[model samples]
Target: MIIALTATTQLGGIAWLIGRPFRQSLLVSLASYAVLSISAIWVAPAFGRTPLSCVPEKGGAHAGIIFCVTNRHYVTPELKSALNDIVDDLNTSFPGIQLGVLDASFPFLNDFPMLPHLSHNDGRKADLAFFYKDSDGRPLPGGTLRSPIGYFAYETGRSACPATRFDLHWDLNWLQRVWSKHELDIDRTSKLIEAATANPRIRKVFLEPHLQKRLDVNHPKVRFQGCYAARHDDHIHLQL
Candidate 1:
């Protein structure tokens, strides 16, 4: 009876989270943590949980040949749809190119779990690695930190603005923490950002303001969130 009651409570909490606004999910997340501490009924989180629902089977790579990075792999249905359609569009814009998903969707039933991110609580955002190219300037293939060894970074002392210095000296601390490589192909990166902004479904893009100026991304949807988080010099974050 006790175990059954706990499971029922967990299910109800999850249902409340899914039906309510995103902001309200924080309460459910906190409650889940508390329950996990006390109840033998608690189980490890489901891999396929999104803000909408926890479908353990729907998480991860799914039917598509999409490459996902890290545990932040729970993909939302809407994001999945957009990605499937945009793959060909990105390929057409830059031939021989594929995408690297840094983060997407969220873990099952825990919208407010303790994560490094601030807004990834719901299944509405995705972060992608910048398109890379070889030294010869040809579009390169997508790779993880291990497979192809894509390493790129910025040197310090560059002037992004007169008042403030740029976040240079490519620090691998974040990458090391997440086990991601910093191999960004700058030229193609810019083009990829441009191509991404062309999609109407991609609501907004977060990039370095100066980098935006350098790329000349005149799209209204492209925005610079300042250097509060690391500069957008390394990856492109897309919101749908």
Candidate 2:
């Protein structure tokens, strides 16, 4: 329980430890986790981090519920501002579309290495799910993520990197078969990338090479994250 809770929510292991001696351990642990998580949201800003919205805002980007529940949605205030600005730009071009965020930095630490993502240790980094469209090319409703947690539903394409093991670049072939039949919205996704790269505060954006070619994104800051990192084909990684 400690390992599972710690891996998902950084604070949950501590809560479980605090509640373990109680008669109703599960309930105590859950309540402890809730209090800690809510407190983190308020306390994090003191350490120069702020949380993205857990729930979707009108015409704005928000992290998926999975990210929120796992306490992975904290980011620097400037990065949060840049995200809102990017959404504003997107709304100007394609009104009413909202972006879905995946994993992000945990609250209350610098360089604490958010697992699976090496660089997200700092609060400046975050992942954004690609906008998707139905088979007919119409935009899906806002907040509709291709995968439940907004990761691992890849847009199949050719890659230069060879297959390997013992790294973060996972090819979850079995899981892909079960995801919804949604197509990547090239126009909106491309625009989102453009907005991110164009933002002065956003230092870099990681995307797969094939995706860059397919989207026709030529921004200098949009670079490949290298094969050692988790595949960027599933979600766009942006950092300050």
Best by TM-score: 2
Candidate 1 local distance difference test against the native: 0.50
lDDT of 2 by residue, 170-238 (tens): 888889989999998888889989999999999899999999999999989999988888888988999
Clashing pairs in 2: none
Residue 17 displacement (Å), model 1 = 24
Model 2 residue 179 distance off true place after TM-score fit, in angstroms: 0.8
Q: Note the Cα lDDT for every prediction shown.
A: 0.50, 0.87
Evaluate candidate 1 by giving its C-alpha RMSD to the native, one decimal: 11.0
Query: In model 1, what lDDT does residue 159 have?
Result: 27
Model 2 TM-score, 2 decimals: 0.96
Estimate, for each residue in 75-133, the C-alpha lDDT of model 1 and write its tens digit.
56676666555666655655555556655543445464423345565656776665555
Per-candidate TM equals: 0.56, 0.96
Give the clashing residue pairs of candidate 1, or none. Answer: 49-108, 150-183
